[model samples]
Target chain A: AQRVTQVQPTGSSQWGEEVTLDCSYETSEYFYRIFWYRQLFSGEMVFLIYQPSFDTQNQRSGRYSVVFQKSFKSISLVISASQPEDSGTYFCALSELGTNTGKLTFGDGTVLTVKP
Target chain B: NAGVIQTPRHKVTGKGQEATLWCEPISGHSAVFWYRQTIVQGLEFLTYFRNQAPIDDSGMPKERFSAQMPNQSHSTLKIQSTQPQDSAVYLCASSLDITGSQNTLYFGAGTRLSVL
Candidate 1:
């Protein structure tokens, strides 16, 4: 079974500080896809980023960026200049390509609290 | 243009009751995914559809959970004999493209299920 494990359950950081959320996965497939999502109290889940293993390119959109490392079987999301609005539950998900299943295995989320 | 739309943002049902969750994918999207999220289990893939056909449902519970996508624009997930344990947030996501590395899933606000 493929599983994405995000060890940190909760973390707090001050505004304008850098915060990192770690994710690691174990799967038999040689390649995998990773995704980051933020879920708020309103029951809305927002897509933050998506990364495929073949392309090591770090996806950056404004203050949010994700780094995918194949060798370490890990992925990390870095928030630069974090703000209060960034506080939410962050999740990591993965799926192996070619399966058409479109089923994504997600990790237990990390709740981030950005303080003012 | 509405990304993914899920109906009945919240539902309350009794054990053994039946509940159905609906999802309308983006206008031109061909892939739709359903996931269940809870505090204990986090996010789990329930099933997926590609090109209006059932692709994979390996993550679904066999007895009470079933999903269908009769057309490209909409999909439905039905749960029979709903139990308190089945209560969770059901999320739907859609992507314009189903293949390759660029497929990004845009999600809905999710439907929260409450069972008594």
Candidate 2:
């Protein structure tokens, strides 16, 4: 069984500031991937970033980056220079490589509110 | 590419009625996944298919819930005798393939189901 946990239910940040959302997972599989997704107010979910368990390097895409700590089985998504449009629900998901189903176990999500 | 397409962005049903959701995966994608999301339960994996074949459905309810992917293009998830507790946003996602280290999933806007 794989489980993802997002300790912060809600987070608020000012424009141009950095916001970090934490995520932790528990899985028996040695190989898996962690993903970050943002659900806009329009109800569409967009992919933000992803980090593989095998890779020790932290992944960064635009203003979105991930702090992957394999030894602690934890990952964090950092949004730099946040803007008002960045306000949305951020979900952390896990996919186990052992299962061919490609099903993702997602966290409860952290709702972010960026104020101008 | 239009990404993954989910029809009936919103649906309302009476108790004991049936609700069916549809999804069209990416053209060359081989894996499709279904998930349900709510404010309380967050995101829950329902089922998935690989190359039009039923794979793991461990997350689906044993009764009253069913899913099928008859071809590589489309899939459907049907819930019989829908209950109020079943009300949630159903999300569909697709991936090129489940193998390899990086399996990034593309998601649709999702269908919001409401049972009264």
Candidate 3:
């Protein structure tokens, strides 16, 4: 079975500080993908970034990036120059490669508070 | 694009009542997914559909939960005999077809179900 784990249940960061939210996953499939999503206070789930297991180079999108440690089955989302608007509950999810269902097994999320 | 749309932003139901959550996927998207978010369980994969067909629902409770995608534009999650434990924010998301390898999901502002 594939599972994702977010050890920190809550985290806080001052505005302009770089914040790193950690996540680890267990998957039998050597080829898989990890995704980050932020659920805003208004209850919308927003896709952030994703990392495929095959890619050794981490992926980045604007101010959001990922530190993927494939060997440890761990990945962390790094948000640079954090802002209060970023406060939300962030989720890490895992999707196995080749599963036509496209099902994502999610981790217990980390609630983040970005204070300005 | 309007993004995915879920109706009834909030729902209140007593025990043993039935709750049906509706989702309208983004236009032209071929994959729709359902997830449940609670403080404890976090984000749980409830089910998914591909090409408007039921794909996988392994995470769904076999007893009171059922999901259907009758057409390309919409899907529904029905829960019978909702209990307090069933209370959660139900999220609906849709993505481009898996064949396209663009499985990133765009989500709706979920339906918050309060089971009393």
Candidate 4:
């Protein structure tokens, strides 16, 4: 069974400050992927970033990047220059590779509040 | 591309009533997924379909929950004898294909089901 965990239920950040949200996962599969998504207030989920377990180098997309600790089975999302508009519940999801199920296991999410 | 579209932004049903949620995936996408989100459970995978075929439904409650993708244009999730415990936001996502490990899923706004 694959599972994702986000220890922090809530987090806060000031405008223009950097924010980091942590996540961990348990998976028996050798190949897997960790995904991050932001749920907007309108109830839409926006894909943020993803990291593959086989890649030693972390993945980065614009201001959003991930610190992937593959050895520890953990990953952290770093958002630079956070703005109030970034406030929402962030979800970390896991998908086992080589499995055609295409199922995603998600974390409890962290409600982030970016104060302006 | 208009992305994925879901109907009935909100739904309310009393105990024992039936509810149906709709989802229209993006054109050309080959994989569709159903997920349930609640304050307590976060996001849980319900079912998935690929190439218009039922792929996996291990997470669906066998008794009252069922999903179907009759055509490529849309899908439906039906809940019979809806209970208060079934209240949640139903999310639908679509991926271009499921064969790749980095397939990113585009999500819809979701249907908020409130069971009273």
> What are the runs in model 1 whose C-alpha is more than 4 Å off?
none
Q: Which DockQ-derived CAPRI band holds candidate 1?
A: medium
lDDT of 2 by residue, B21-63 (tens): 9999989998899988888888888888988998888889999
Q: Which stretches of candidate 4 lie over 4 Å from their true place?
A: none
Between prediction 2 and prediction 3, the one with superior DockQ is 2
TM-score of chain A of each: 0.94, 0.98, 0.97, 0.97
> Against the unseen true structure, what C-alpha lDDT does each candidate score?
0.87, 0.92, 0.91, 0.92
DockQ of all candidate complexes = 0.70, 0.76, 0.74, 0.80
Candidate 3 residue runs with Cα over 4 Å from true position:
none
lDDT of 4: 0.92
- Fill in the DockQ of model 3: 0.74
Assign candidate 2 its CAPRI class.
Answer: medium
Order by TM-score, highest first? 4, 2, 3, 1
Write one digit per residue (lDDT tens) for candidate 1, span A1-116. 78899999999999999999999998877666888988887878888887788886888888889887888999999999999999999989887775545567888999999999
Q: Which stretches of candidate 2 lie over 4 Å from their true place?
A: none
Q: Each candidate: RMSD to true structure?
A: 1.5, 1.2, 1.4, 1.1
Q: Kindly indicate the candidate among 2 and 4 with the higher DockQ.
A: 4
What local lDDT score does residue B17 receive in model 1, on the 0 to 100 scale? Answer: 100
Per-residue lDDT of candidate 4, residues B1-116 (tens digit): 78899989999999999999999999999899999989887788899999889989988998999999999999999999999999999999999887565378889999999999
TM-score of 1: 0.94
Question: Which lDDT tens digits does candidate 3 get at residues A7-59?
Answer: 99999999999999999999888778899999899999899999988999999
Candidate 2 C-alpha RMSD relative to the actual structure: 1.2
How close is chain B to the truth by TM-score, in each candidate?
Answer: 0.96, 0.97, 0.97, 0.97
